[model samples]
Target: MPSLYSAPVYWNEQQYLLSFYDPFTFRLTISLYIAGISLIPSACSAPGCISNYYPDDRVHIFRVPENPPELKQAWIRALHCDNIDRLKVVNVCIKHFREEDVEYIHKVPNGDGTFTSVPRYKLKLKGGAIPCLLPGCPSYYSSTSTSKRARLSYEPKEKEMLNQTIQLLSKI
Candidate 1:
C-alpha cells in the first residue's frame, strides 16, 4: 500500500495562512467604525431640508420626540416622511420650525416665589412644537403664506356704523 501523505501544498494558491486569520475581529472592527460614524447624527431628518449639524453654527438640531403619539405623527406628517422607524432616530433642524416654536430660554422656578428665566445654551422645541416652515419643500407644503388675500368688503350697515363711530370720535 502507498503512504497516505504525499502531495505538496501551495500556501499562496490555497490561502493556508489566511485560514489562521480570524475574520470576526476584522468584521467587528469595520462594523464598529461604521457605528461610530453614524453616532454623530450630522444630517437633518426633515424631507427636502439641506441643513446639517455644525458645532459652531447657530442652527440647532432637535431630536424627534418619541412620546405623545399625536405629536410624533404630526411631525411625521409635516416632514412628508412615512418611515416611522427612520423618524424615531432622526433629528429636525431649526429651519423647519417657526421662530416662536424654538425656545431660547427656559423658565426655572427658584426656591423662592419668583420664577427665573434662564437662557438656554442648547436650543429646545416648545411643548407640542411642530415643523411648519419648510422652504425646501413645495409651496403647497409650507405653512408660510405665499400671497396676501384681499380683505372682505364690509356690509352696508357695518360701513354705516363704522362711519358713524368715526364721526362721533371726530366730534369728541
Candidate 2:
C-alpha cells in the first residue's frame, strides 16, 4: 500500500500543493499528480486573528475590487485595519460580520477529497453593517451597558434641575 502524501502541481500558471490518499487501496496515484489544481489564500481579514483555514463558518473568503467601500469600512473599523495601506490581497471573513450583515453567502466544494467549501463569486454585504463580537473585536451592541456607563460617568442636566427644585422647596 502506498502512503498518502502531498504533491506540488502547477495549474493555471499557479503552484498548488495537492493532497491525495486513496482509501480503497491506501495509495496515491500518479494521474492525480497530473491534474490541475489551485490554492486559495486563507488568511482571514479580522484583526488579531491568525486563521489560515476557511473550514469554519466564521471564515469568509472574498475578492477585493469586487467589494464595495462600505463593506470594507465596516471591517476596517471593527478590525482596526489600516484602510489606506495593505489593501491588496486582503479578505474579510464572516466572523467579523453579523448574519444579517452578510447579504448573501454561497460556497462550492473543491473535489479533491477535501470537503472545504469555496465561497462563490456573488457574495454581497449589506451597507452600514458593523462587525459583531469576535476575537479582538469589542462588542458594540451592548447598549444597556453603555447606558449604565453613561449614567455613572455623567449626571443628566434634568436630574440636576430636579435636585435644585427639591432644594428650593425644602428651603421654603
Candidate 3:
C-alpha cells in the first residue's frame, strides 16, 4: 500500500525527500527538482476551498507595496474586513503607521499587542477605512465567551469593500 506523510522536508538537486511513504515494493517521485525544495509547502489555503484565510493559520507572511494609493488602501481594508474567511466575519483591528509621509500599517494586534512583522506588508489606510479584524474569522464564527458576543454581523457593504481592496493588490 502507498501512503503519504507530511513531514518537514528539505532537499537539493542531488538528493530529495517528499510526502510519500517508505517503499517496501514501490517507488516515489517529486514534482520539482530543478530548484531546491524547501521543507515547507508554498502555502496551505486549501485549493479552491476558499474558506478565505484564518489569522492564526497565517503560517506565512506577505508584504504589500505602498507606491500606489488605491492598492495600499485596498490591502489594508481587506485585512481589516476579515474577508479572508467565507464562513463568517471577524473584524480586524487596523493601525496605519507612517513616518509622517513614508507609508502605512494596517495592523491586527495579537494577544501580545504587537502587529505581524511581514516585510513590506506594513500598510497605510485612509481615514474612511473600516476594519474587519473581528475576534473570530476565516474559521471560527460566533462568540464563545461572555466577553465578546457580537449581536451584529457582517454588513452588506463589506463585500464590495473587500473586493476592491484585493483588486488593488493583484495589479501591482
Q: Which one is best on TM-score?
A: 1
Q: Which stretches of candidate 2 lie over 4 Å from their true place?
A: 1-38, 52-58, 63-71, 104-123, 137-172
Mark the regions of model 3 whose C-alpha exceeds 4 Å error after superposition. 2-4, 7-15, 20-33, 37-73, 79-172
Q: TM-score for all predictions? A: 0.54, 0.40, 0.20
Task: Tell me the spans in candidate 1 whose CA falls farther than 4 Å from its real position.
Answer: 1-41, 53-58, 83-88, 144-172
Report the lDDT tens digits of candidate 2 across residue range 1-172.
3346655455644443455565664555343222343233456656666554432323455443335554454345545666535555666566655565565645545777545555646667654455454665455531212333234334455689899999999999
lDDT of 3: 0.38
- Give the best candidate by lDDT: 1
Query: How good is model 3 by TM-score?
Result: 0.20
Per-residue lDDT of 31-146 in model 1, one digit per residue for the tens? 11132244333568777775653323335788877786656666777777777564337788888877777889888999987899999988887776777778887877776431
**Candidate 1 structure, TM-score to reference:** 0.54
Q: Please give the CA lDDT of all the candidate structures.
A: 0.61, 0.51, 0.38
lDDT of 3 by residue, 1-172 (tens): 4455544355654655554553552444333333464443233222222121322233332234344545444444434434344523222322222223223444456898888744345444443232323333453332223221121123335677899989999998
Q: List the residue pairs that clash in candidate 2.
A: none
Give candidate 1's whole-model lDDT: 0.61
Q: In terms of TM-score, which candidate is stronger, 2 or 3?
A: 2
Residue 89's lDDT in candidate 1: 73
